[model samples]
Target: MKRSNRLVALTNYFLENPRLHKQLPYFVNRLETTKASVSEDMDIIDAVFRNEGLGYLQRTTGAGGGVKYIPEYLHEKSEAFIHEMCHQLADPVRILPGGYLYMSDLLGNPKTVREIGRVFASAFSQMEIDVVVTVATKGIPLAYSVASFLDVPVVIVRRDPKVTEGSSVSINYVSGSSRKIQTMVLPKRSLEEGANVCIIDDFMKAGGTITGMINLLEEFNAQVKAIGVLAEADDEEEERVVENYTSLIKISNVDLKAKSIEVHPGNFVEIGDRK
Candidate 1:
């Protein structure tokens, strides 16, 4: 095949099987071309991927050498998208009676959620994540979105035990905002032993829910690789339960009486800057 055709096919293959490594000889044989010609095609494809902020194509040397496609969303693009979300979240009309900003609209948007997933996936891409874990309801979409990009399955924790899920483990945790104890249930067989889990959530006040999920994972002997949230409520009085977590947007301040809300980029801004 022609070099142009080879480049297109190679690009598609990388996208279809991201985070996969393939030896140069495999490509050369598949394309029925010399190693030098295949290398030339890889160069063009790699350049396009990096220049377009698509991802990274890493080349390894030595006896067990190969090329790996690592998906990455450029920090600049992620920052811009997140800042735009902040503006949307800053709308005073979204402020509810309990100072909760209405985010159902944002969470329901497939396009928005997909982008947020990409941001989370990019943020935690360095980790060896095997499964995405989240609570039922609001967090399901976010969890699925991140899992899709990472090519992993999602494990959802439920408020009430379901008969359909079979045997399950339950744990009680304090609700940061409500200041009440609540039980969360997870299926016993949902996760495997030593599985690297990435926790994703929609909003966090004191991180009580995420904390509960962490405790529940203990039963399955899974490791928490990373944590990510779409937004985090900045409440000074309420101490955050989880220390190492990333959020896309920060709710700095909210006033129901004044109908005022303040939002800005979250910890990801600092993290993304370093990258």
Candidate 2:
């Protein structure tokens, strides 16, 4: 490959797989390029990315820290990339008999999960998302992944009380799917008044849990910067509550008999408008 093409590929690779970029010496040696040359190419790529309104790329200094890409790029290509992954996750074969899809693989896959997190973090790139919030269990990992990209702290909402934590403020919320009354608790010090909060979750059914989370934020007098979900099940009944939220993938249907699934892009097509 030509030098220019190689640089572009390297930069794009780093953007997609940041953890790999951190081991720069290894990559540099493998590519048979000097560290200085790689550094110069990275500078050029970073400039091009930012100039094109794609987003900014950052490199951290020191032994442990390394090059990282903070994507500001909101484009058709990125959206399509996320949409494709959502479709893959929507496979009907993955859907168990209970109409619930097995998404643990997608959620645990580091590359896929990180990409999904970056997609949402990009949406809040401009906003001051002081902290990321999510309910206990499944949402915790998603919340942590997004928080890592945003370089912000994560505040987990507990579904049940735990003995290790100190005093916590609790709220009663109805589950969107079950419509059963459930309690969510957060440490009083987890967030502060007037904090710019971003809420993230793995799935959304009724959005009642999100509503309760929003209420919890209100109790702290924090402003919800935005709400994002990895995947949303297109259930007509649960649609009412989550009408205002944004989802990366909209799973419209799962034809178990045919082993087919339907998916679509979310309303985030115009993420740049938020600026």
Candidate 3:
């Protein structure tokens, strides 16, 4: 094929596979091109990617060397997108009976979920995570989205035991909102010992559920690498059980009787990048 065609194909290949490294010879053989030609084409692609601030193409040398496409969501773009989300979430019409904001529509949108997942992946790209853990409910979509970008598996914590899953390890924890005892369980074989886990959730209020998940992880001898949430309730009177977590949006104020709500960008914007 022509050089221009080869360039387009090469760009598409890199776009399809991100955060993975391959040897230069691998691409050379796949494209039926010489090392010199591949290197030249890569130079052009690398320049375009860097200039666009989408991400960077990294090249290495020596025995185990190749180019890796590191997918990144630019901070400025992410901030702007989140600003729009905040506005939509702050609508008074979305206020629920129990001071909750309706977010089912946003969570159901594939395009929105994909973008949110990209942001989470970019934020935790530096960490070594073995799997993404989440409860068996609204958080599943966000968890799978992050798993796709990270190329890891997702382990879901269930409220009730399943016969198909075989034996499970169950625990009881007090709900922060209702202050009532609740049970949560996980399959015995769902996670490996000493694995690094990233916990994700749809919403957090007082962080009781997330804390229980942390306690469950302890039983398996696994380490908590990170915690992420779609929205976190910021109530001054109530202290959250899980302190260290990244949220995409913060619900600072909610008045159920008055039908009012307020939202702001989450901590992801401030502490997303790794040093």
User: Candidate 3: lDDT over CA atoms?
Assistant: 0.88
The C-alpha TM-scores of every prediction are 0.91, 0.74, 0.94
- Predictions ranked by lDDT, top down? 1, 3, 2
Ranking 1 against 2 by TM-score, winner = 1
Give the whole-model CA lDDT for all candidates, comma-separated: 0.89, 0.76, 0.88
After superposing candidate 1 on the true structure, give the runs of residues whose Cα lies further than 4 Å from its correct spot. 29-32
lDDT by residue (1-275, candidate 1, tens digit) is 88888888888898887777789889988888888998888788889889988778889988989998887888888999998999898888898888898999999899999999888998888898999999989999999989877878999999999999999999998887898999999988788888999999999999989999999998888899899988999999888889889999899768777788889899999986786
Q: After superposition, how far is residue 68 of candidate 3 from its true place, in Å?
A: 1.8
Residues forming the 10-long window of minimal summed lDDT in candidate 1: 252-261
Once superposed on the true structure, which residue ranges of model 2 sit more than 4 Å away at CA? 1-45, 48-54, 57-70, 255-260, 270-275
What would the per-residue lDDT of candidate 2 be over residues 114-230, giving only the tens digit for each residue?
Answer: 777777777777686899999888888778777876778899999886778778899998887887999999887678888899999887777888999998888899888889987
Q: What is the lDDT of residue 185 in candidate 2?
A: 91
Who wins the TM-score comparison? 3
